[model samples]
Target chain A: MNTSDAFHRYTKKVCGQIRWKKAHDIVSREIENHLHDQRDAYMAQGDTESVAEEKALLQMGDAVSVGMALDQTHRPSPQWAMIGLVMLLSGIGAIIQFCYYDNALAAAPAGNISIARFAFALPLGILLFAAAYFLDFSFIGKYPYLLPVALLGIDIVAQLIGVDFNGKNWLSIGRFAISPISLSLPFPLAFCGLLYHFRHKRNGYLLGGLFAAFFCVQLVCFHTMSGLFVFVCAAGSLMLFAAVRGCFPGNTKRLFLLFVVAGIVLFAMFLWANSYYAYRMNTLFAVFRPETDPQNVGYFPLLLRNIMEHSVFWGKGNPLEIADYSAILYSGNFRADFLLTFLSYEYGWGIAMFLVLLLTGFLAFGLHKAFRQKSILGQMVSLSILCTFAGEVFVYILNNLGYPLIAPIALPFLSYGTTALLLHMALAGILLSTFRTGEVFRDKELLTFLKPPLFQWDNGKLIISFKG
Target chain B: MTMDKTLLAGSTAMLILKLLDGQDMYGYQMIAELAKRSDDTFHLKAGTLYPLLHGLEKKKLLESYEKQTDSARIRKYYRLTPKGKKHLHEKTEEWEVFSHAIHQVLKGGLCCEHI
Candidate 1:
């Protein structure tokens, strides 16, 4: 057999026995190249072609032994450390959710809905995580149109039958309740797929990105202002990514002008749309003009500032019990609005900082791994998801850090909303699966850890040591 | 000689890390360099070296990337990571202490012999 043929037979014998079959191609290619190089070196020694091939093959030692050693090297091992960290963060948040809602369940006629939803949402989120982890994350990219199609479908349905909740329409499914606007959570992945598909065609890139942004705005305008803000921030990050890769239209200088002009137009149109959005602007304006709408629009901001005035390094934590019912209830019902104020007023800033650090760690590592991916599809999806994570965390913290609460973003690990919990967990699972798939890159490393070294010992005396 | 085939197993990873400490090289280059430096006393077959190089990469002690040469062939290069360099330094110190002990024993120069 030719050198190439012999190398293939050897690789098949070894890699075929390994369970992580995805790694066979890389291993086979690498080993074949090695064998060919060796055979050439032998030919330089003036050996005949067949003899050189034979000697080169022989130098590799036993075929079965080498295959087995390689097979031991390429096994798939899950990263439990990161998974554990995510679980711990989520668990702490769930505990706090339970404590607050459980205590308030007796006093409030709403029957502690926040705590109940958070508790039920945790397991569902985990189930989503498990499913996403096992299933290939690239499935989102497989049908690149899936996320956008799904988003448009949800938006249409919500418009048709969505019910009003706290001035915004929320879609309910039979007995189950869900906010249609929150469905925008997965929009980034779909948007990334669009960008990935049109990464070459500059026109398609611009059109697809703008179309994706418009759809996100459509979903947000009908439901929540915060959704629109989050979506815009995420889209901007993706644009920056595309610009850096030279995928954006014309140059980045033009793109910056487009952003400013678009911002002004959107701001003008947003205020003119409805009294609901106008009222939100008034709330923002109330931040500076405190006397503008005292006892109404400006009330919560005043309450937040008062709460911040008594800041401690470590938070008091979620109140043991809602001692001052009027504290949260009477001042424009700031239960959800001032979540940070409540958190700092109860838990301490330390918990908030810790939660943010944990999430930042997860997102940072996930992005780092994804960027390392050689495939553009992988990088796009990873960047999209990471951008979403960063956007949510940043916006939420900004709103809390003495800024007018323009939006109430659900913290990754600490928030109590079912929609937010489920969405975060699902995205998290996708990131984890991507990281797991990265194992195929280190097939050589996996084999090393999969099997222990062979050591011969007689009464604890070292006789032979085989590393692989 | 046949029995000593397994002798390279335990130290193969360590040796590979040492070679990759400052310089980056691929599988074939590593084998040829190791053989050349050891004066042909060590023969690291293609099979043995590839697996060991890959294993070190998996452990994250070494990282690999491919470079394109003028010959139009892509050669995969390996380098020591910070973790790997620290490991190599520790192992070098360990090997010295271990070999020094072995040398003392072989020369019948153990202090315990006087006792």
Candidate 2:
């Protein structure tokens, strides 16, 4: 056999039997054709048949290497990951529907299940199914960057239908009965995907334009302090990533122009959309004199007092529960507070600090790997996610201390919401993808923790090392 | 003249475009043409050639289709698009202007003596 044929045989042995016929067939055919060509070339060079074949095989390198390279090319794309996400979300939606509406529906007159409940669950369930189905077909893989835009469309439709027909809050679908925030999980997932895509592709103009449009739409549609905060944080994080990654084009003048335009538009939209910003501004300015607005600003003091009075250094069972209860008792906002109450109340001070350290350490590790490994995209995504996390932490801390006017964004991994789940999952996906790139921490030495100890005592003497 | 290997490698697209200006060819044929045109001076490595061809194909600058030769061997044939031709022409003109300017500066007034 010629070099190509030898290489093909080697590769087949290395890769084992590929289960997917289409992929396996294509790879096998390519190998066969390549070997044939190499054989012909060797023969034309006037070598004996055996010698030519041996020489051809020598030129093909190790079979395993060729098979690995081909496998890399044929590796399934993010389509599978997307499908998994959609299925997970659908499962979550089904569970939520069954839990909240099942008993209520059974008790109600037949066909009179609350419009609010149905409105909240149906669009969300449909959205999850549609996203999953679309992902399975690989429709969104080509334009992964556009996934967020599609999600935003779903959120808009869900919000419009929920509010107009069901008379429910955009976030909490019914009267504290059922929430559609789970449906909004796709938005954050899509956002993470977009960030990943843009990091690799660096289409700054498109990203900038999309952010601007999203900000404008959020301003018009919701006009809530929470909405404005989400828009600002999301847009700002993307822009920051773009800047750090050197994806944003244009030197000083152009950069200045873009920022100015963004600032002006954001300021104008904030002004037009809601008056709550004024309250937030006033509360921020009067942080020390929180008692002036006791019901709003004083909520934090009351919660802190409750925590301090109720338990010791570690405080309650879960900082999250304490925070939730405190919010309900003091601020009358039973909605889960992302940072302040959850961290301090549920995990308590010590555990919360430990959790924070662990999270920060993981993020730092991801960032170090991303940058050290020369993955600009990974670095950008890590940095952007880090910024979001930082902002969430900051807002939560401020809200806990005294700035209750600031809207809560659920703490990372601590809050139980669709957005939080999607965000964490996306973060996991990004880190995994970065790992797969083989840019970071590939050396066995870096994973020394997983290995057995370097030395072991045996019969009163120390054995230096263990053999592999 | 000694060739800058890095420069030649970097300008492989230009070299490929220049070669394809004369004829359409399959990957192996193009590789052979490159070697022949350069008087056996250059051989495109498989690792580099496949990725470059794939990239070009992705960018729509080149289109490929399979055809059976007289020997009944199926070969993938690649040809430049109208857009590719225009891009090649523009890049060629730019490269010529750039090289001429560099040559003039490097020669330090000996350029006119050669002319």
Candidate 3:
């Protein structure tokens, strides 16, 4: 078959495979409309019926290429990256808190794991998916502004009544320990809404400012080194967005002066925020001095050694085996070793290398798309996701290699946590949205749709019907 | 044309409500009727029409049913709920007031320019 005929067949096959009903219909109609136009052109040129049909198919191009182009429309956005980063970081933070701070073996805190399981992970996952599907709907989209406000208001009211549900504190309601942060899953969702609004509005600068403000607020609330690291990563991602968009303020001198002033202010705030900074600084120093607090500082090193000695290549079936081996080998406490130790013990070096290559590929592809897309919204969204992952992967590696400054951040898709899962899904959704809206796909579809009679409305209505 | 575009988009819910107000019609019939009424000025694209229809259905403004047509093809037909009529009435009033104000402004501007 000719390339065009092959392309047409590919398009039909791929369009049939699209899972989302709306997306599938949109793509199928577009392809059919293009094919119809080609047929009409061939007929107008005085070709015989069969010859016109064959020529039309040939001119329309390859189906797989067209299908691939159409498929890009559903790729996720930078918000997904930000979500993944936060979720992974938060999951790692929770794990760290549990292993080191919470005394996990001490009676298990009277319904802690159950609350973590049912309240946090399960409900949050469901809520994230629901929000993703409903984001574009009018009723859902129109009043989504109220969601974050309502969540924040409810959290405040609950707090006033001495009820805590954020998983920070355990509250017993009959048989269960209910956490409110379970409901706060929608806050990140609010960020997604905000991102979409700003993206459509073409307000990249505002998006960056909002991201910075949100990161600062998170840092203040968490008051941990990991939180600050995430904040920095978020800021860096936003800056990358700004730089990509060329939306930086025009007055370079003034902007520089403003940055200098801001830097000074931040430095002063850092000094004022001594407790948090001091804790981070101490931890950083402790990385070098493994004996400083062996339970905390030397824990990962001992665990890594045990994993290496016992089974350097696929050490154990259970990830927790590293902890068991460390306790026995170094007479150290059983804390969750950082992700690197978990990797070495559980999967082996091959898996780790594979994961690195996969992550590198994802980041490279994401960055390439970001740089190529002209739309500031698309570019910023893509870049933000790439930077967030880059920062996350870097920090995770640093933490594992005896730099033990911050808690481990989960690798996207691989780590277990409601926050991570939701975040990845959100990022994927955003990228998909961007890919759908990209200029190349837009132009091709626009050309097909703009043909005479197609663009002509029948008294303010579209002429075609998919059902027919 | 602009007025029609606004009316069509703004009154999409109203159009669906009005169409369903009388009797049930599948998406194809609804589009054909919409085109015929508008004198072929607004031909509804399936992409645009279906989403709006589905959105309205989801909001319970319209109810849909699947039945075998005479041609033996299963067709989904939509009919207006009472809630949809109420919504349409509210939207119609809003649109009338909005369009009247717009018309007055444009007419006044033309008269002033003539003077």
Interface RMSD for all numbered candidates: 7.0, 12.7, 12.5
The DockQ scores of all candidates, in the order shown, are: 0.38, 0.01, 0.01
Query: What's the TM-score of each model vs. the native?
Result: 0.79, 0.49, 0.47
Count of clashing pairs, candidate 1: 15
Scored by TM-score, the top model is 1
lDDT of 2 by residue, B1-115 (tens): 6666797776788777777775787665676788898898777654355446545754667766555556545565678877788879999999988888888889895795655
Cα-based lDDT for every prediction: 0.68, 0.52, 0.51
- Off by more than 4 A, model 2: A1-57, A62-141, A144-146, A163-168, A171-207, A223-231, A276-278, A295-311, A315-335, A338-348, A369-390, A416-468, B1-115
Number of clashing pairs, model 2?
9
The model with the greater lDDT, 1 or 2, is 1
The Cα error of candidate 2 at residue A90, in Å, is 18
Instruction: For candidate 3, write residues A1-468 as lDDT tens digits.
Output: 533344346456756544444455445544554455445556778986567666655554455544454454433233455345445544544553444333232333233333345345544654664465334422223354665566455545544553333324333444343333223223333443344344323444455345545534544443334445554555545554453344554445644553455456446545655656766676667777767676775655545554544444544533345445545432212233254555555557555556666667667766765675534445545555556567666766665555656655445544433345566555544554454444222212223333334233543765643322
- Residue lDDT tens for model 2, A280-371: 66666556665676567555555555553453347564343554655453331222453334445554666556655655655566556545
Task: State the lDDT of candidate 1 residue by residue for A150-224, as single tens digits.
Answer: 777777786678776665556776434665545667777777777665655646555754665475567456656
- TM-score, model 2 to reference: 0.49
